[model samples]
Target: MKSTVADEMCTEDLGNVLPSVYKSVRLSVASPPLLHVNASLLLLTDEALSEVFGAVVEDSEEYQTLKVLRKGGITSILFSRPHHANVLDMKMVEELTTALHSARLDPTTRLTVTAATGRVYCGGHKPGLDAASGLQLRDGLHSLVKCVLEFPKPLAALVMGPCVGVLAGLLPLYDVVLAAKGACFQTTVVESGETPCGCCTYTYPRLMGHARAAHMLLLGHELECGEAQRSGLVTEVLPTTAFHHTALSTLHPLTATPPPALSHTKQLMRQPLLNPLTSVHGSAIMTNTTQVISMARYFAAGVKRNSDNAP
Candidate 1:
């Protein structure tokens, strides 16, 4: 991918500023004498910052399912396919993985934020796939979740509507989850006769407790925003009118922190989960993939049976 002029300038600015910021953070942590050092001096000028952050990079390539917009050290990955209810099929999953990968490499992006268009954050998996496409979808979803887990920078999810299926599975992986009023979350894997993917087996229990996780995954419970917040699944819930503003305000602190320190903190916090998650990721994905194929075939047979018996 060719770097745009704005991207190049942002990279240059980050190159100029990050080393000094990293040094200051290191010094502040290592030696008491340097604790009072001013880190703000390393910040880029307002004009340069505007130029770098204000640039919006639309996905013009093969995968146009999402838009990547950068502003003030934050990269917002907005779901673009409202017509499809932002379903995470194989193709969209691949695109999301690629976007996250690019954001991870982008020097100016200190944090990544995810949001979707329309009323549903994600409507769930693409329906009715054969065994081959099911396996492909499973792999793509696994890759997408892995990218989110391994992303060095902080990850935030801004939920303005219902978040369901595989997308709901990803909520626990986010560092911060800000939901708008009326937003709900549910995992429909059981309903579909498939197991959970994206390490939800591990993350849901940790984030929302064992009982709630079991209730959700096993019984297919839908969690409203308040219940989600109480269960610790959501960081906060705000009015739809104020969600974007509140989310930005909440993320403002990260801009002041050194990127290295932020990344290090995120890594340390995630290390324990990562260890167990790695071992299970492959097996879970494979199991779910097989289940998806089987479920599809079963449903197809049932539909055929009904059609044959119908008038």
Candidate 2:
């Protein structure tokens, strides 16, 4: 019997890599376990995390990293050590979400999910991280959409990054949201100077209307915090210094909600989005999985070709 590529990779090899098959689960709480749910902030490696941030801020990778974390039951408050970039890349999302889902299944545990980033989280400097070419980006988004559509629990996001990209649109799906001070929102595929794809264009028309959505997609203008609030994009904004305090406030209320209520509310809210979107999302994911395997193959081939070509 032949071993599958997935079977060939060990958990160690799977970590810290693009489209990581092995998800790393870290227990962040310091105190002894409690009956009530606690908050979990998910993040990625500096380079990987930075990639997601930069793509949205610099290039617009669809800001799907935040989408992924929220799906898996964690409110991703992305923070990177200053000077280190905080870009939530695909591998990080996968591992973090997998960890969250795993933790959620434990009868004793409960979690509140939010997404944010540190001052400097980035993927490495390489075209491989490009959103259009990003196997991991698409894969990660696919995972989140699938999970979110059918998830038996509530999820939310905190958008605070250069490129709020797809996250702003997705935030409306959540029961609650908090946008950081100075955190601007935009769905522009042009002014952001990044090529906007199908996903970027869909949200506005679906949520608002054709004319409004077109203004956003075509003008490439950003919605400042106030504008975002007016547009119903952001629920609230806090001074950068107050992000933690605001998070505590947002999460505390969430923690107090009974698990069953949270789960039920999440399901009901998701029905409209999930009903029409599931088949499309499912097809995309299947395609994404295929692309990942193919990308991995090409990656391996390039290495071999390089070795053979080298003197």
Most lDDT-accurate candidate: 1
Steric clash pairs (candidate 1): none
TM-score of each: 0.77, 0.56
Candidate 2, poorest ten consecutive residues by summed lDDT: 22-31
What's model 1's TM-score? Answer: 0.77
> Number of clashing residue pairs in every model?
0, 29
Tens digits of per-residue lDDT for model 2, 146-258: 54445465555555433334344345555566665555554424432233332434445666677766776676555565666666666676655445456545666665668
**Local distance difference test, candidate 2:** 0.45
Off by over 4 Å in 2: 1-84, 103-109, 120-133, 166-169, 188-202, 279-311
lDDT (Cα atoms) of all candidates against the true structure: 0.69, 0.45
lDDT of 1 by residue, 1-311 (tens): 55443333222321123212111111111112112212211111223223333544553775577767787788878776545556666778888898899889999888888876444466677744566777777778878888887888989998866677787888888889998777778775465567877788888898788999999888777788899999888999886654556677887798779999999998899898787987777778778867877877887898899999999
lDDT score for candidate 1 against the true structure: 0.69
Q: Which candidate should be chosen as best, given TM-score against the real structure?
A: 1
